[model samples]
Target: MTLDPEDEKILTLARSARARNGTAEGAAVRDETGRTYVATDVNLPSLRLTAVQVAVATAVSSGAQGLEAAALVSDAEEPAQEDLAAVEDLGNAILFHAGLDGSLKGRYV
Candidate 1:
């Protein structure tokens, strides 16, 4: 499916992060103000977080009242419930799921 240029930008950011960090997944979120946040899966020995969760946390911590959109680049067929909850907590932001090759797979809103 074709996406808006802004949405495509986040997807590219997510895919780049996953490749650069060698993580299982990567995610990016666009805030209501048009600011974007990117993150890879956090797998510390003491704390584990999905990429989408981290992205959402970063956006929130940065004073984003709500999200406009989010992108998740992963091999998983579906995003984790926790990740979805994170985005939902912010607002009704569209969530785009993409494959490693940057192919659009699914969308949630």
Candidate 2:
């Protein structure tokens, strides 16, 4: 799908986070206020969180009441159910899926 520049920015940020962290997944979320948050899969021994969950949590912690959009860059066929739930908790936001190479794949809402 064609993304607006703002959405494209988040997609690029998600792509870069995955590349930089060498993680299985990376995600970025844009809040209603136009603020964006990025995160990679967290698999520490004490805690495990999908990139989407982390990004959404970060936005919530930062006082974002709602999200405008989100992007996930991963090789997985689809975003995890838990990840989708995380996004839903905040509000309805289109979740753009992208490949490791940063190509647009699909979108979920």
Candidate 3:
């Protein structure tokens, strides 16, 4: 990603929103073609740095481990806070993203 200053600002806004909610982690995924894009899951952790900043830093650094290198803030299901908290102590849960293929899968980690 070119990650212009404006892009960094957008990422900063996104990060701030996520952190304030403490509800999501952000990451980018690469397909078989090596074409990569980012997805924001409301359940993952907020990146302290802007998305563009992280992307650029990782791109320039030793390289990124892809989604494995990012933090997970929430589950994909991301049930309503009231709904989940009310139940109390739900077991291990999984989140899925509905892709264009009509499949519920983990699009981002």
Q: How does each model score on TM-score? A: 0.98, 0.97, 0.24
Off by over 4 Å in 2: none
Question: For residues 5-83, what per-residue lDDT tens digits would candidate 3 score against the true structure?
Answer: 4334333443443455443444332222233334344322663443323332443343433321222223344323332
Q: In model 3, where do residues sit more than 4 Å from their true spots?
A: 26-109
Candidate 1 lDDT tens digits, 5-108? 99999999999999999999999999999999999999999999999999999999999999999999999998889888999999999999999999999999
Ranking by TM-score: 1, 2, 3
Ranking by lDDT: 1, 2, 3
lDDT of 2 by residue, 1-109 (tens): 5789999999999999999999999999999999999999999999999999999999999999999999999998888899889999988999999999999888989
Best by lDDT: 1
Candidate-wise lDDT, in order: 0.96, 0.94, 0.33
RMSD of each: 0.5, 0.7, 16.4
What residue pairs are clashing in model 3? 24-44, 24-45, 25-44, 25-45, 43-73, 43-74, 44-73, 44-74, 45-73
Residue clash pairs of candidate 2? none
